[model samples]
Target: MTTALGLVAGVLTTASWLPQLRRSWRTRSTDDLAWSYLVMLSAGVGLWLTYGVAVADVAVVAANAVTLAALGALIALKGVGRGREEAAR
Candidate 1:
């Protein structure tokens, strides 16, 4: 039951970011997203993934894995876009 609860919570928390991810991907707009925040969040999620792997918790592993991927993509998009904007200047 605890594991099930964890999975449910993980799903909810992870899914919460889906809309933002989708929107960012569609619009390629991340001007409002902060670089430091994304970096810190990615770091924190990486730690959670490490903990999940260490303990062999499927829910944590899955959630953090997907979250990290999405975060990585967003960061890449934001970074590249920012670079392009600077180059255009």
Candidate 2:
């Protein structure tokens, strides 16, 4: 039961990023997103992944892995988009 609960919580929190990811991909606009926030979030998620691995928790491991992927993509897109904007100027 605890594992199940953990999975549910993980899914919910992980899914929270889906919409933002989709929107950013579609629009190629991360003007509203903060670089500092994404950097810190990715760092924090990395720590969570490390903790999950140490603790051998499937839910934590799975969720943080997926989240880190999403965050990575978002960060890449933001960087590329910013670069293009700067190049245009």
Candidate 3:
């Protein structure tokens, strides 16, 4: 049951980001994404990771680990890309 739930959660969260990620990649524009939100979200994910570790929950740890990395990548790339855009202008 726990494994099932983990599977569901993993699929749901990963799939939820698919559309936005795809669009951002294709358009090469994450300007619509809010930096503040991502910043806060990354912090929250960090907390989630810590909590998962404290509780010794593998699913929580694994999911948050992968998600945190992905989200962090997006945030970094978006900031860098935006900066480049500003400099180019």
Best by TM-score: 2
- Order by lDDT, highest first: 2, 1, 3
lDDT of each: 0.93, 0.94, 0.83
Better of 1 and 2 by TM-score: 2
Which residue pairs clash within candidate 2? none
User: What is the Å distance of residue 73 in model 3 from its true position?
Assistant: 1.5
Across 1-89, the per-residue lDDT of candidate 2 in tens digits comes to 98788778889999988998999999999989999999999999999999999999877899999999999999999999999999999
Separate clash counts for every candidate: 0, 0, 0
What lDDT tens digits, residue by residue, belong to model 3 across residues 1-89?
A: 98898789886895666676677777778888899988998899899999999999987888888778778777877988889998999
Clashing pairs in 3: none
lDDT of 1 by residue, 1-89 (tens): 98788778989999988899889989989999999999999999999999999999887899999999989989999988899999999
The candidate with the higher lDDT, 1 or 3, is 1
Candidate 3 lDDT score relative to the true structure: 0.83
